[model samples]
Target: MDQTLSPGAAADYIAAQENKSLLRFLTCGSVDDGKSTLIGRLLYDTKLLFEDQLATLENDSRKHGTTGADLDFALLVDGLAAEREQGITIDVAYRFFATDTRKFIVADTPGHEQYTRNMATGASNSDLAVILVDARKGILTQTRRHSYIVSLLGIRHVVLAINKIDLVDFSQSVFEEIVAAYRSFAHDFGFETLVAIPLSARFGDNVIERSPHTPWYHGPVLLEHLEAVEVVRAAASRPFRLPVQWVNRPNLDFRGFSGTIASGVVRTGDPVVVASSGVTTRVKSIVTGDGERPEAEAGEAVTLTLADEVDASRGDVIAAAAARPDFSDQFAAHLIWMHEEPLLPGRSYLVKIGTRTVGASVTEIKHKVDVNSFQRLAAKTLALNEVGVVNFATLAPVAFDPFAAVPQTGSFIVIDRISNLTVGAGMIDFGLRRATNVHWQALEVTRQSRAAMKGQQPVVLWFTGLSGAGKSTIANIVEKKLHQLGRHTTMLDGDNVRHGLNKDLGFTSSDRVENIRRVAEVSRLFVDAGLIVLVSFISPFRAERAMARELLGPGEFVEIFVDTPLAVAESRDAKGLYKRARAGEIRNFTGIDSPYERPEAPEIVLEGGTTSPEALADEVVEYLQSRGYF
Candidate 1:
């Protein structure tokens, strides 16, 4: 029997010890919603705080900087000093505590509606959730907002913590009414457990210690329910899963893989395979900080050395190989759009799943989940704080399970390399069947042969500018002049290419990068086949264009920057995009919703708006003539 245990710890621990419980959960409501008051009362009444910590709280209360007396529990949840005074959980702050019965990790989340992304982060790995609803108001819009996120993250158990019962007159009828309303709203989510309790977090009514004030009510207190429920163990029982974290090698000759065991047990001589490479090896030994172990189970941090050498490294997962993870290029998944920039297709993002990271893109937007109605809006895009199911296609193969089958393995985050912020979080739906089986056939003409046929060195001329800048205008005249001069050339215009090649793509930063990549590849083939390739596009990112440069030689690639200032380009207004952008009709628009970084040190600078179209075309021809193409 597990001896030293708190009601909170025992229930989660017993579930985890048997590979059952491995996660803890907590919710933060708005600052006015009693989030601090509830957590503070629970710790204070349960005697969890150290004497020094309690002393500090008392001392600080007397000299109070921001929070008041009688223990502002938000202080305990806000792990950062900046957050404590600010009076909000900025993001997800994890805390660990233990009793003799079980150990637990708690996810403390923010309450504001705008920080829904942070809320998603808090509950992403949780097995259970406790939503703090003010007793006086019963349930606010934020309550439903958080609950939707909790359900989306796949947390099974949800406890409706109706806090500040003292303010609600401790009325049993009000509690019942709130419960009924919550149940009705919650019915759409399809959660497993929904337990609503009446309590004043300031007074510690039913949080840990049973309250005599509610003699009329006869149900197990919040603490009793937490200890008695079985969730962690259930999760552990699903399958053996371990996400390879880091390649461990203390010495040159000692090679091992180290990661916290996500699920299941492993013994020496167990056969395992690296998912990325499919190399199979037998486990030679399992070592932990505690000492050498013959067997390591789920949740234990261990270093595993194999009997055979393999190219296993970071972003690779080791598993039974028999139970292969769900694999496909495209699948449906839920997303929390965190970035201010909206989502669009043909954009590439680094998908960090488990320990593996790869290039991925949202190939299609199926629909957005309507927050108010819970109805799915079959839209092409999603904006900030929106929840939606988008189709993702990976550049390389990925090993994963459905977010439902394995939350840790199925989960992923999209990071913006420029901003260095996690822009999105997602869960895969393996059964998200869609049509994406279009085959691409390269043109029969190869670049080396095309260059020989043209009687001049074939090259890719990439022109970039704002959407309406003279890119297409200049590229058209350049192609016509080259045609009349009897020189071989192929012009790939953004608008013409959009009709067939990139028809499926939309206007988003990620999509634009992907669009440029596809166009770049085609240009490389043209250059290789001996034909001069002319490409006109608003290739926005320097990094993406740099990739194009990497694919060709100095002579074979020429970067022509259509140098038109934003103000000048807007005045031109060749298309209505500038007007629409200014009107806020869209978001993340290049030069408006999103920032467009101009090319630095481009091979050629063309004054797109000022120079005559034919003169710009003549300038390119002269450059070609100097290269002996004429």
Candidate 2:
């Protein structure tokens, strides 16, 4: 093959080479595991480097090489100056190369713990993961972490490359022992293919060519195995799904829904239904950038003209009419927290999947998974690099398949509404049964009937303020006065509930949101029972409070802001919590470490510092009486 060609000829030749299947793969391992070196060696042996590039590599290796008088192969892949200076990969760098049999896109991902999110980004699009293990340090924690993430991302094909074989004397027994240990631990992970290869990537042994250094190993070299591996095509036999990315209306005469087929196949005259609106139509034609096509399969970007004008727009999903994907406003999913700010339950975010984006919130966190141990640890919030099972609620129903069924439609990203930065990645486990299967059961005796029987209207009085601001005190007095007045009532004190209902939650912003959520739900139930529910908690976030209000029926929720100065609360530190928070003994404590967002408007504002608890309770009772809730 010629080393150089004219620009136009090169482009033509590359385009003509589409007959070859392309494999997208990545290399991942712990720090100093030679992932970059292995990729550098692969590129070098494949003759992909140009003469000028090689010359520069040779000169740079002399100046920056870790090994004396030997070219540092890692320099070929670690292109960033910081990476070169630190001698470690920090970002996921992608490179394109080809062998005689297949074209390849190789991702060199960082291995540091802090950069695990970057590794996950690379693994999400990869077909195979080449997980490197240092022969001398076999099966470290990070190796397990990388494998777990690859499995989570649904990469079934994995190659355990035992690099640095020279350091371990190329011992076949050592390689076998490591492989056995890994297989034992991953018995339940359900990987379709797992191949273990022992090779020295630095010396170019068993990388691109067969090396006599590992004469005991008879398996094919890395490149040979990669070229021969069968590619797993998408499931074209399943129901068709095309998430409309754009509505093509270039001219008044032609209208088409343009998007990449997420799964299955679409042909002319195929009956399709809009997932969001349930509007059914038949496909009239399939058009691509080149021209009209008879059919299109998954992974192919094409446009489809409907037989009749129907409600089809961007963010709407088109699928087979008979087997439409599940559409729901609620789902159970596995979430990987990616942002430095911990994920707060009940905080609204943008959930983006396929071409659809909608308002969403992490309604509940079921549990966090310890990647190294695979243990399900109870957690109220997910911190950076933590993985958890959670429940998500979107503002409106969105179409999706379970991740196990369709990778493209089932996966999504969580974007912070304020920053618009991607904060988490999620895979849909399944839609919540209550959200899909259960319908509201109408009762003969309704909430209004219960209120009439009690001779009063049911309502929830939500008191929110800084800690030790007399919310609980005022609430307790109000509940007592209501009880004496024969008014049906129940008081949900925040600290009292935490002793049982919210025992698993801490005082982090995420946990506080969840605490308020649980309380508001319980209060709603109480109100349904024709009781005046008093919910007193340090619900610091205004968004979560708004959500609570939205969860109730009209005029059922009332926000009573307990306005008290932070200095006044600290001075009256009943539990000594304020002193402890000021002393740094407690973290995420509102008015000390965390922020306390004041409610912009409330039905009532009582100065807890100036008024007695009894007087505040009397004021609340007067307001309730004025509202005809005697």
Candidate 3:
């Protein structure tokens, strides 16, 4: 298939290439299992490399090649200096190539356990997985781990490329044994197709052409199988979904919702509904950059002008009226934690799903999966690369479908709010029934009215500090002064509240998070009742404190940090808790074994170590008077 052609022939070839069906697949296995070499072999056999690339590869092979006196095909894709030096792929390397019949996009993913997140990213968008297994090594731990991730990400097809078969004398029995073991573990993976092929990637055997070394084996060559496999575009068969990325309005007479259709099809005069509001409308026209289109299906970006000017905005899903996605604020999902900081249940995070971002938290960890044995084990937190089934609660309802049904809407990334780094990825399973069942019962009385009756604004004064840091003492004094001044106030002490509201929670990091969460909710309720609520607690984690702040209205929550030196607080431990913590009797004691993240920017910072409790109380009262609280 020489690409050199006449002008007319070249134009025709370009057109044919554009129409060829594209396949996206990834190569994954344990380290040294030859993922990079397999992809390099594919590129070489397809003749997609230029003469300069070949010369560079040859020179680099002499410098870093593992194969003696032969070109190191792995050098072609392992472009990073560290990768070439280490002789292992660190990041995912993507390459494009084509045959006369089909076009292919292949991702050579890393195989080390530490880089599993990188591998999962590659698998997320792939339809097929080329899981290479060393013929001599059989099935290893990393092999199973990669396979589990592939299944979790909804890949349906797998090609078990048993590489280095020449090392095992191309033994048929060895191949069968490996395939049998794989099938035994992957029996429940639900793959539509699993084809096992024996190949030597370095020697180019059974990759693009048949080899005589393995005469006993009979199967389609790797390239032929890839070109013939039929991968159904699942989104095109499901219900219509278009998550509005932008609300387009350029003139007084025109308005359109622009987005890539996540699933199904849309046509002129077709009735559609907004997933958030259920506002029904018909598609007036489908507009593309090229021109107007009669219809558009999944993966096509188009602007849809509605027959009626309904309320569809960004973060809203526009879908076929007959079949709409689930709208809920809570759901169960499987999360893959990808950060050095372990995922703590009840800690706040930002969830980016579809075109929407919302404040969310993992309400519960049902269990974590052991990738090796696929066993479900109890877990309070997920470490890096660990997968867990958890329940998530969002601040607002989101429109989505189950990942198995619609991936674009179901998958999401978890971001750290302060740093804005992606810490995890998850796939939604289903909407929680309780999320839809619970409704806010409206009342004639409201917070504004209650505050007006009290003749003062409602606010929550959050006092956070180390243990024995005089938080409760200072808070009590502030509340008493406010009460004497005829301003209604209430104080919630950490030890007192735990005796009733959170008695069952322990002092672990996870329990501490839940403790603050419960207290935050109680403070919110107290604020609604028009009382200046004082919360005194050792709220160590900054993330939980930020969550509490977000729960209140602007200027309604004041964070007061009781700054005290650790030595000073420990010496003033009248409760003897510090003694027990230092003697190893108590675990997870803040300022001892646990951490206390100091407030980065609190409204007020009082030096409890140097100042008297009365003086701190007066400072708080004076600040309140200046703000017109009384």
Quick one: best TM-score, which candidate?
Answer: 3
Which is superior by lDDT, 1 or 3?
3
Tens digit per residue, CA lDDT, model 2, 1-630: 868989998888877688789999999989999999999898888899999989988998998888778878899989989999999999999999987789999999999888889999999999999999999998988888888889889988888899998898889989999999889877777788888889888898889888888888888889988998886866676679999999999999999999999899988999999998889989999999889988999889999999999887899999999998999999999998999988988787889989999988988889998877899999978898889999999978899999988888999999986567999999999998775556779888888889889888999999999998999999989999999999888888888999999999888777787788788778888888888899999889876787788778888888999899988998999899988887899998998889988998898899988988899889999999998887
- The true-versus-predicted C-alpha distance at residue 65 of model 3, in Å, is 2.6
Angstrom error at residue 284, model 1? 4.5
**What is the clash tally of candidate 3?**
0
- At residue 573, candidate 2 shows an lDDT of 91
**For residues 1-630, could you state the per-residue lDDT of candidate 3 as single tens digits?**
976789998899889999999999999999999999988888988889999999998999999999999888999999999999999999999999999999999999999989999999999989999999999999999999999989989999999999999999999999999999999999999999999999999999999999999898898889999999999988888999999999999998889999999999888999999999989989999999989989999999999999887987899999999998999889999999999889988999999998999999999999999988999999999999999999999998899999988898999999999789999999999999975556789989999899999989999999999999999999999999998999988899999998999999999888998999999999999999988999999999999999999999998899999999999999998999999999999999998888899999999999999999999999999988899876
What is the lDDT, from 0 to 100, of the residue 539 in candidate 1?
87
Least accurate stretch of 10 residues (summed lDDT) in model 3? 431-440
Which has the better TM-score: candidate 1, or candidate 3? 3
| Residue 135 accuracy (lDDT) in model 1 | 75
lDDT of 1 by residue, 37-115 (tens): 5666556766689989887777755554344456656566666666665666676777665544555677777787767
| lDDT, model 2 | 0.89
Each candidate: what lDDT? 0.77, 0.89, 0.94
Q: Which candidate wins on lDDT?
A: 3
Worst-scoring 10-residue span by lDDT in model 2: 230-239
In terms of TM-score, how similar is model 2 to the real structure?
Answer: 0.79
C-alpha positional error of residue 134 in candidate 1 after TM-score superposition, expressed in Å? 1.2
